[model samples]
Target chain A: MIQLIAYLIIIVLTIIFLIKMIPRKLKKSPPYTCGEPMKFEKPETVFYRTLSNILGLKKLQKLSTGNLNDYLLMIFICFMLLLIVLVMV
Target chain B: MLAPYAVPLLICTAFALPVFKNEKLIKAIAILAIFLSLSFVLSSSIEVFNSGTKVFAVSGFKAPFGIVMVLDKFSSTVASLILFLSLMIAAFSSKLVKERVKEFYTLLLLGIVGSLGIVITGDIFNMFVFTEIMNIATYALIGFTAKKEGLEASFKYLIIGSVSAVLMLLAISLLYSHVGTLNMADIISRIDTNDIYLKTIFIMLILSFCVKIAVFPFYVWKPDVISGSLEPVAAFFIGVMTTTTVYVIIRIFYTILGIYYSTWFSIIAIVTMIVGSFLALLQKDIKRILAYGSISQLGYIFLAFSTGLAFQGMYHLVNNAIIEVLLFLSIGTMLMHKKMMEKISMYAFLLGALSLIGIPPLSAFFSKFFIITGLLEKNLFIYAIISGLISIVTLLYYMKIYFMLKQGEKKIYWPIIILIIAVLLLSFVPVWLQIFKGVEVDLLARNEYVSEVLRP
Candidate 1:
């Protein structure tokens, strides 16, 4: 039981560290498009606009995702959970 | 007495890197180190074959308290293959790796040492440490090019590999907690007494090994990383790395856990075989296709072992390693041609593809036949049919690659002819099965592995 708690704490701390390391200024960038700039966009609404653009919910949006480390991490977490269940069973 | 040769040779080669001013001297050192290691492997294999088993207690400490190196038929055979393939890859690396030549050889030798340690050591903690060393060296080797794709692939591998390592460590901890001994033989002696905790630890260990073997769902990183690395490095990684891991898995399952619970294992093996083959048939990139083919082949080996066919599994492992090395060597040679990308050599590709698909008279066919026979002996008729169907799918995928390559018109190189002959000679050699026959032939009834290891 104590070991399980320790594992949970480590996981939480790692996730917190990842989130805190994100750059605030970079997160506030204007909405990005593939070829053209937005002319009738509200500057105050840039965060949502950029989020939509990155998620491909906006016109001419190019979702340029970089590495796949995050996805691998998620799959690894899933496997670990599966292992824990298999052991506990 | 000669057991320390592996570490010292690696250290000497690493230290003498700066003194060698000429490229020829560096190449000579690389070849010398590998040749000496190969000789050690050969001598040790012969000793094991004659005397049955030889154990080296490091610094003269007793079992369960100190590190032990056991040279049995199983370890010696796998070790010999590792050394021989490393020699061939080192020769190939001389021409292949121009950038960071010294560092390449250093890491390559270190990786070889780690793998050898994993094969020979009887202590579980030492196995974990050796596995880490091997993983770190291989991760660096994969990212040696430092290109964007290489870095990305390495990062992906690093993340997945770390999780696997953690799982393995956790499994070790569980075992230690239960058995109170890290020695494999000691653990085996105590395994039958424990009930619930033993099953928990067993499941954990199997899960960790599944990650290492990349069975079915745990295999996503292999294709990406293998395709992204350089040709010779890719060849070495496939030829040696995966085989050693699978060998260790076999050791753990058969020698440590015993085969009383083989029914559970058989189910897992069948799933991995079917799924891996289906995925292999859908791949497009040549290297990715080969990577998937290797996973499927490993599945067949697992199936053979789960049905209490240790000799057949070992034979399949040896044959698969030889075929993969020859195939990758041919691919590496073809990749060196100036116009290779413009018009890929059809003959070279066809030979590689045919060898992978278990074509008649090839090394793969013999191993595949052994596995099918084992399955039939166990009365696994449905699995036998599934295995046959997947074998056809494997042939179809490989034939597609061959036909696509053969569609182009280009003069075949001399190296391709050499590779063809090497593959043919390997297929003709009955050395592995002969060794199996010489030893206790019926591995199904009672495994001779532990007895062989403790013989001396």
Candidate 2:
């Protein structure tokens, strides 16, 4: 329905605004203790850093580091998505 | 009809300020803009009182046809309280934002604008829009600290907030599909109480609001979000923003849906009170303690609403806002703004703490009395008794906060002193101007709200 799609559009726009507009440039930080940190010690590839900056994907920095809380977030989102799919179907 | 520029004036000022980019001027502008907003709100509230409900029908469309902003007493009262607390926050926090001054005030104003919109709008979709605006602004502000804990807390809020938003949209879609209207009054007029989807929509809407207010089983974000942010921001979150959500939920039940599902609501309220009290007792941090206490106060307000004493519930709402604002503002100053903090006297600190704990001769106690009285009047003796026991637990934790401060040298300042005087006078002055009496009773003026918004 148009109403359903309209709702999704509004929520998606909000998500984009959250990711792209807010959360200022990530400052320099110590490298991860684990091995996932890309060896950009010489500071190559501005595009990757830009991607990291805009999306705040701490993929490399947060490698092998985690919290129970993050796991809980995972579970919550999964459960909610399941419910939404069920209702929609 | 008062023009609806009051909300937009704030939004326009916020968006226009980035070019100037001066910190002092930004603070001045935020404060002045909030002050003007408050002036318009109070004056407009007077007009609403004299006339009927004030409707700002956008684009020359009326009622069910357009984005309508309706200011009844209930909405205006909450809106004005939000603006009042916002002004205090702006003035209190001006000296605090050394970095990101413009962004801070801009987000703060935008958040206020959202809250005002939430309180005023008659359309469910507009309510969703306002709620998201408030939540997003809150997300960015919570992230302002840039510390991992702050961001983590903010992200937690984002996830949960996003879930609530989706639920809100789904609920609105359900309502629209059922009745083909987004206007709250129109939906109410067309609501088929016997239909099963009505119950589903009700539950969904209640769930969405519960997440925002951090009710039981969904309050995981409250402790982190309240403790991680700066103290006044925490105060604003717990005091004003939570009040807005609860107010909307309460209004939905009272004004629109007409209490077909009140028993379910009562269950939620009772559980939130007891759980929130018990959790507050477990917390060591003052912010976390206040956060949990905020939940407990919300439970009391909910209890009042379930008993069909929305007026009493609103009294407690306004009263709780004052108590939380005083507690958090003083505690925040003590923790963060020590340099600018003037030493608060025991009279002020003890009054705020005792008021929160619901001691006699304070407005907080009186509001609780009204709620308890309402519960008892409805013959919900069990609920009244349990609520009483929770009050004891509440006093225990609030006293814990009081004793925690005793070990340190205490500090109270002019703002707190003024608040202390205001609290005492608000309760002590027993004339017609009793702050609780006017709005407490009128919050149940359903006919006025229904007629003004629907058939105006």
Candidate 3:
């Protein structure tokens, strides 16, 4: 019983701590890499500029696609989870 | 009983560690504690090997009425690996960990103890408890540096890990509902009798374990978290913790679930191999690249194990553990030099990279060869070919790192040389083969292990 209460307290504290730490607003400006200053008008523009700086967007035009990699990874994980559930059911 | 001593000893030593304010004294105590644990692990492992299997019923209760610790070949192997890697990391961290030495060692020891419990425990509920202990220690250790990246990585790992834990707990509850017992062997014996819920529980348990082992699609957090943490801790996890998880999964699959219902295992192994290698090729960061490489390597180990050749798979496990330790130690050595380890040092890193990539005459090549052979023996020809091809892709990424390190300015260091020699010796001498042979054939086969655990 005591162990259960301690676990609950820890869980509540951790959740509160995480909620407090989440950033309130997304910064809209040029993407920062290693604290190097850059100029960009919009967040979307910053994405392209950052990509060009990191992986050379001009050279990557042939391989670039509208689909985001992070989205694809998320989709993959979701599919796996779904498969696991289906198998269990 | 000796079974429970492992956890209390580790916890007591961890608590005592912070009392020593002096760095030197703390290091001495940490080393002493770790060495003592290692000796205990060795003796216990030998006992298990000699005795076929031994079970320790906790608190004077019998079988399903109490928690039990089971020491068999699988658990003993994992325990030995954990202790061996802990010893190596402690030696490496003696010089590496600068600030909060006591806290670091405490967390490290705690992590080891938790993982050891996970490996040995026969009770499913105890497994969950041990998993939580291991997870908390890991989260704290990852944030030990207190840097922005470290904190961010730890938070990410913690969130994902918690979700995984919940999934596991739900599965365990479902199993308990069906079986009315938490003891693994007891549960296994009764599992086949339940026709309606058997498949559901099996799938849930397997998925939960896959998440823990970082197989295929569930492996996303591993690279970021491992790469962002302290090098010694990262190395220890890669060398020991992940492998132990894999061992537990294998134990559950074969000993608990029985290998007759293992059709999904082969499919998962193949997918993990292909996807892991593909992603590894795209990574640029040195540590992240190694992390992905480990994922790919583990996929091969899984493939080997699922092919019904347990001993051969066990061989790969030992080999992989040795190689990972050598590679990570070398990388850590490089990072400790004059310049902070960054995007540079690509040239000197080639040896370790090439070996990992399975270039001939290195340790990885032989292990990969045996895995393929095991697959072929099982008539898994397509998988054997796929495994071979993925290994080729692994070589390409390894070369990518090699070329990058090559382009960096060359600087000779004594630690790098010593690390290189160590890697070479491990790969060339084949010390593990002799050690395992001696243990399994001469000592363990005699059933001394069971007697030790069953002894009054």
Candidate 4:
């Protein structure tokens, strides 16, 4: 237990030392493509767009069009399907 | 005895709010009323733990013949949780809700009354009535801002909720026709699961509740609804409204129908989880993302229930509710004071997001761990894997929000601070708490529940 405690203290001290002593550089620069600065799409937007495309989420979102008629239609379809499935079961 | 007082107390307070012109006085009265109701709920829960189920037959009429409020271990525990969360929301909303103070408090108290009524009632018809009251209050609350988007979301939810309510009422009528009683226990005793009519009734009821709890295909309204509402109201929806609906679904399936697992339901749960996670990934707005995350979490709870992991499901439900409330209320605070976002609020938000992602030593992590382990025990390795993968996706969206709000000043928001502390303390629940003791057994002990409710 003593050894474990000593190890934990050492780890804590190392973290504190690293945080306090590290020379930090904070600056903003445009992305470099070859020798020129290039405009880049935000990574978050790119990631989400890629994910949405790969998952066919646009199709799903289209189905959830926030239309009252569409929602009612979906519920009706679900209800009918449930009835059919349960009757078969 | 105290169990029955929550609904009446809140209802009376709601009506009394309109009489007071002083906004501070109205807020004080509303908070005091909910505080009193919460105290009563806790006291009643203690009584239930010390003894057993307490059944109050309304107006001296016996069960099956009149309205009854059955306060059992399950009901009392859920009711206490609901009131506790409501109290938190009420306190937070004191500053959050600015316009139409009387209307807001009145509607909020009425909504609480409806929620408590749903939790405690023994009659299925009465449950339906309470649900309507809750839904109506929610519709007005969702559109309280009177913005275009808010009104649109409210109108949409109104249409869906009305249709689902009709389906539920139809199911109840069919059930009454077949069993000749509206009392849940009585219906359980007479229910013939093998019969086609009975099966139809069960499906209708489940489908309606599926919509109410925002399961997939029926869940599209939830994100829009949450995004449209004021943040505190959104917190109420995520924390109390959905949680109570989940309780109602569990009560009906576990207690009334005595059906523990269903393949179709599990399929729907899996779909709901996948859909919610993917949709959440595509969202830029914090509220919409959390809303979709909530839908995904509901899928987890439903999947656990589908596999007969009652304790794990309930644990996840409670943890998810806490984390969502923390996140929403924190975001709400930031929105309320946009120029003065606080470090404590940001830390609280991050903690909630991490917990929702099932990070180590957090309350949600344990619940997710139990759920995964429970699934493994049931030999559902694929479902367990799916749940874990979705947790990663949950992390992705919440991290997106984290990056957006990485900077804030050092200050304290009391409600978020309290919730953060609560989230930390809940991590100890698995090891030290007996709060959920016998709850799982009680859920499965339909025979005991029925006998007690039907006893002479």
True lDDT of residue B419, candidate 4: 87
Off by over 4 Å in 1: A1-89, B1-4, B339-349, B403-422, B428-430, B438-456
DockQ of candidate 4 is 0.27
> What does candidate 2's lDDT look like per residue over A1-89, in tens digits?
43235334433543443344222444476466576654433222242345346644344224213353653464356446534542343
> Which scores better on TM-score, 1 or 2?
2
lDDT of 4 by residue, A13-80 (tens): 43453344333443479778899988666656666688789888887878778677877888789778
- lDDT per model vs. reference: 0.68, 0.72, 0.68, 0.83
Candidate 4 Cα outliers beyond 4 Å, as residue runs: A1-37, B431-433
TM-score of 2: 0.81
Ranked by DockQ, the better of candidates 1 and 2 is 1
Q: What's the TM-score, to 2 decimals, of chain B in model 4?
A: 0.97
Please tell me the TM-score of chain B in candidate 2 relative to the true structure's chain B.
0.93
B428, model 1: CA deviation in Å? 4.2
Model 2 misses residue B103 by how many Å?
Answer: 0.7
- Per-model TM against the reference: 0.80, 0.81, 0.77, 0.92
Looking at candidate 3, what is the lDDT of residue B376?
69
- Candidate 2 on B204-244: residue-level lDDT in tens? 77767877787665665677778888877887787779989
lDDT of 4 by residue, B1-456 (tens): 777977888898999889998899999999999999999989988898888889998889999899999998888888988888888889988987777999999999988999999999999899999999998999898899899988988898898899899999998898888889999889888875589878888788878888888887688678888888888899998899898899989998899888898887888899999999888877777789889988999999999998888888888888888888888888887767774456788888889887877766789878887788777778787887788778777777777776566456676667777888889988997452356656777888888988998898
True contacts kept of each: 0.19, 0.00, 0.06, 0.49
- Counting clashing residue pairs in each candidate, in order, gives 0, 4, 14, 0
When 2 and 4 are scored with DockQ, the better candidate is 4
In candidate 3, how many Å is residue B59 off? 3.2
